[model samples]
Target: RPATVDYMSVDAEAAEVEIFRDFPFADFDISVISVEVQAHNYYELDTIFVTAGYAKLAVLGGDHVYAKLRRPLVPPQGAAEWQRTIARDFHAHAPARSEIGRSQ
Candidate 1:
């Protein structure tokens, strides 16, 4: 049967691009992906991820993290979304902005 992936971690050495191409990202909503990329061709892999609606979040050593922006995660959502949520919640709780920052 087919399955949905919330996260995927791939360490394909030099075959990272080939491995990534095997997945049909168009059919599923993948939340996050971590792939081990080679210094010489990580950009190619990044282009593929970008075409699939993923954004490069970070790079640690040889591993890179990509998040599918079309569907965002909660609790620890993306920084931009988190900021919006914080502002909205604050405004709902305190409409007036006092010297302390919260609205009276």
Candidate 2:
């Protein structure tokens, strides 16, 4: 049951996620938990885009799997604002950068 689902750890899987740091995204104490309960399932973590920390994931499967963002999704926003938000996060907490570096 638990195996059917998956989670992205953020730092571990940054490159694969579609995000921007220029904007702003609030972080949650707990990671977004995605689940899978399908009777039968087949998936490859590599084939799919997943991050270890705060990245969005794309799982290959049917309704059997369910996903919930432990970190709530940001409210809708304009394109430029959204891009900045993603870029900011990516630049700051991206697996590559240090948390301190982002605040600047």
Candidate 3:
């Protein structure tokens, strides 16, 4: 079995916490996690992830994005530049556009 998971997108239907509790994340390098969580359960999720050395990067609708930043929640240098790069990449590869127009 693959113990190292770099990214996990979990939509366990409110059983996310239960599922996560069983995994030994400390044994591997988990870079990003996107989990389905109820709005009311944000606090619970926050505590669990924070204790596990992750920072909540964003909360999109019912999903939350968490990343292990090696430190507290402060943004790293050139945060705006990173955001712009991400946005550009997302737009360049958007599904509505044709592959012929996408940058390599």
Candidate 4:
């Protein structure tokens, strides 16, 4: 088994939710997941992802993309601590200000 999975795309037709449920989330630090969902199992899939600390990013065609709610830290920190770290990092790397010009 690999140490971590950066991305995973699943198209299991009617069995997508079943396959996703069987995935080993505890064993892998999965950053992104894309799963094809049908109306019958959309809620189940969403619940599974949300419970696993993932948030829906987008829906491309029939595939729903989910990203990790909190990026895994090396030392394994708490969620609140991780959020603070991310906010600090974002501000540190982001531009101080932005200028938008409109053309008439």
lDDT of each: 0.81, 0.37, 0.80, 0.82
Sorted by TM-score, highest first, which candidate order results?
Answer: 4, 1, 3, 2
Name every residue pair that clashes in candidate 1. 96-103, 96-104, 97-103
Two-way lDDT contest, 1 vs 3, winner? 1
* Model 3: residues with Cα > 4 Å off, grouped in runs: 1-4, 72-104
Best by TM-score: 4
TM-score result, candidate 3: 0.60
What are the candidates' C-alpha RMSDs? 8.4, 14.7, 9.9, 6.4
lDDT at residue 19 of model 1 (Cα atoms): 71
| Model 1 Cα lDDT, one tens digit per residue, 20-89 | 7656887777888999899987888998888677899999889999998875343355678888988999
Candidate 1 global CA lDDT score: 0.81
Q: Is candidate 1 or candidate 2 better by lDDT?
A: 1
Across 1-82, the per-residue lDDT of candidate 3 in tens digits comes to 4356678898988887777766676777788999999766778888888877798999898999999776644346666877
Q: List the candidates' TM-scores in order.
A: 0.61, 0.23, 0.60, 0.63
Residue 6 of model 2, lDDT score: 38
Q: For residue 85, give model 1's deviation from the true position in Å.
A: 25
Off by over 4 Å in 1: 71-104
Local accuracy of candidate 4 as per-residue lDDT tens digits, 8-103 = 888887898788787778788888999889979989999888877788999998899999877432227667787888899998887546533533
Worst 10 residues of 1 by lDDT: 70-79
Tens-digit lDDT track of model 2 for 1-104: 13232333332132212332221223323334333423232233221312222343445442122234444244457557878988998877656535545755
Q: Tell me how candidate 2 scores on lDDT.
A: 0.37
